[model samples]
Target: MSSRYAFTKTVKELRSFLTRAYPIMKKNNPHVPILIREGTGALPRVYARYDLGQEQTCSLEGLSDKQIEETVTSLVKPTSL
Candidate 1:
């Protein structure tokens, strides 16, 4: 995610959070693949793939790091009953 847009600060925060969280995410979710692309003209978004070709997404455009993390954790992390 590039931070050149209007929501630069939030996006940067997200990027930094992802940088630190990526490894932990991978370790916890070994079967999941996380792809991070940095470039211009790309909206901040997260995609989670599940069985049967199903996919979920969350827009991170102007969200703070905490919000981003919450959204991601809810999407990717398995919850206990």
Candidate 2:
């Protein structure tokens, strides 16, 4: 997929996953930044910004396994899509 498409998909997936893990994620009065770095000739890298009192990069390397599934689930739900 293109960089923009990949980024969109990744962010959507993250949002869904976070919502499931933290029921109040959508209402967590905090601004989160999701960044995607597209490789020159390789797969894109996903990054997430977390400010749990301090800024830190979330360990999303191995955490996106469920992203596709969660994203798909959310897409099917009109209210949550």
For candidate 1, lDDT tens digit of each residue in 1-81? 454556677668888888888889899879766788876667878888877687888898788778888998888676432
- For candidate 2, list the clashing residue pairs, or say none: none
Q: TM-scores, in order shown?
A: 0.78, 0.33
- How high is the lDDT of residue 47 in model 1? 88
**What is the C-alpha local distance difference test score of each model?**
0.78, 0.45
Worst 10 residues of 1 by lDDT: 1-10
Per-structure clash totals for the candidates: 0, 0
Highest TM-score scorer: 1
The lDDT leader among the candidates is 1
